[model samples]
Target: MSNFLPTLQQNSSNNFQGDENNLQKTIKPQRGFKWNSKQPQKQQHPAISSLNTPTHNNSSNSSNKDIIDFNYTPSHQLPYLNNRNFNNNSNVPKLAQVSSHKDLKKLVETTLNSDSVLEQAIKLPKGENINEWFAVHTVDFYNHINMLYGCVTEFCSYDTCPKMIATNEYEYLWNINGVPKSVSAPDYVKYLMQWCQKIFDNEKIFPTDSNVPFPSNFEKNYIKPMLKRLFRVYAHIYCHHFNEIYEMNLQVLLNTSFRHFCCFTKYFKLLSNDDYGPLLELVNELS
Candidate 1:
């Protein structure tokens, strides 16, 4: 596992910057704005309807447009831990004992291959309450970003990443609660993390139990926008900071985590085509 880890990491780093010019050409600068205040009349897309696996009949009460059809299976296969000289019955190491990157890597390899672990990781509750699922994944993605960016904080600064946009030109703006602000990349990411943290920390909106109702317009107003902004962080990392990630020898981890995230969001249609278009090349290669 250790021997293959370095090789996989190296391969991911080598291909991480594939066809930058092509990516730049395809990327349309995202606009800064809030969602429409009024909900659009409910319209159903066959593709969306086919994918939905709702646990409740909230569709009769809420706008069908707001409900995502999450019934479709993911087309892409996630990367798996290579099993060698492994027994299924072997006891897996506890997370608290993982004290180093090497230990963490081993833990990941072991856990990912375990059927019990994979089932838990991939399973989502059947319901109209997408907030629970969204909240869980949101925290998961934030942890990934924290690890990936935290590794190279010294290199991630205003002088290095002057603007939040991946391209050198100022084509994109950071929109916070409907207001656009142009700032350094580090600052933009900082605010983005803060916003996500605030949402995750709030118990009223993201309750621990399944019985609680999410605030009205929560999915349309907050969850969707949060996902869009999160994709920007991914864009910035893949476009600008991949080399730094390579230097830190964390490419494989980043690649695997990012691929999982892409597949998860894609399954739910959480990201728009324009939002993920820039990174599609990399995403395809990783898949």
Candidate 2:
């Protein structure tokens, strides 16, 4: 393995800049009216914050969706990337990798309770360096979404879901290199995570050595774009698999995780109004 001791500044900078430009362009303009919600936060699950998610009582969230017994395999995952062996998450940064060992199997087990999730999201720890703080939480949020989505992989198949959609209105298409591709939801999500994984694994982008400062454009160029895409994963899961999430009694944990994600993104202003379009209402209603 090559140590990312010194960044080839010109090359690395140009590469990410090119990627940023490509990411700025969407496959098609997302159709929606943008408005800040002044709606009162509705009551949430006892263990989570008030969110604009469908309650279990909602008729659309049937407890008995046709669930298949298939394990999802990402057909397009990078060859170097293999199945997670939970015991060794060397690929993940040190801070993000901590404390997760206590419960990897219990997907519903959340690290934060309702009262603390939002409060914790916005407060940078007193001793923490901001970029380093972002580095850790970025990895944390990624893992949270990753585990949450893993729960519904079998249900969100290419045949079952042709497009990566949220709210039945916003359909997300993947950008391959510089070209946009209208791929299946599973494929689109897989491609998106791969993009994030690549960034995290690259020390220049997310430094494994704390001594090596984060790249100059790390937050603006990498973190925001990465988190923006991660939000889509949440949107897709909430829109398409909330029923399954509800059935498994994971809705509270899912809601809490998503709330934490939203609060963090909102605090940092990492995303624009356009970026949150799919989940805008919920975001606006976040208490």
* Candidate with best TM-score: 2
RMSD of each: 20.7, 15.2
Candidate 1 per-residue lDDT, tens place, 137-249, comes to 66566656655666556666789777776444323465544556577877776766655555544445554334456677667766777777777777677667665544444
Give per-model TM-scores: 0.59, 0.64
Best by lDDT: 2
lDDT of each: 0.49, 0.55
Candidate 2 residues 183-267, lDDT tens each?
7777776676656665665556665444567788788888887787778888788777776666654666676677777777888
Model 2 residue 127 CA deviation (Å) reads 4.0
Show the lowest summed lDDT stretch of 10 residues, model 2. Answer: 27-36
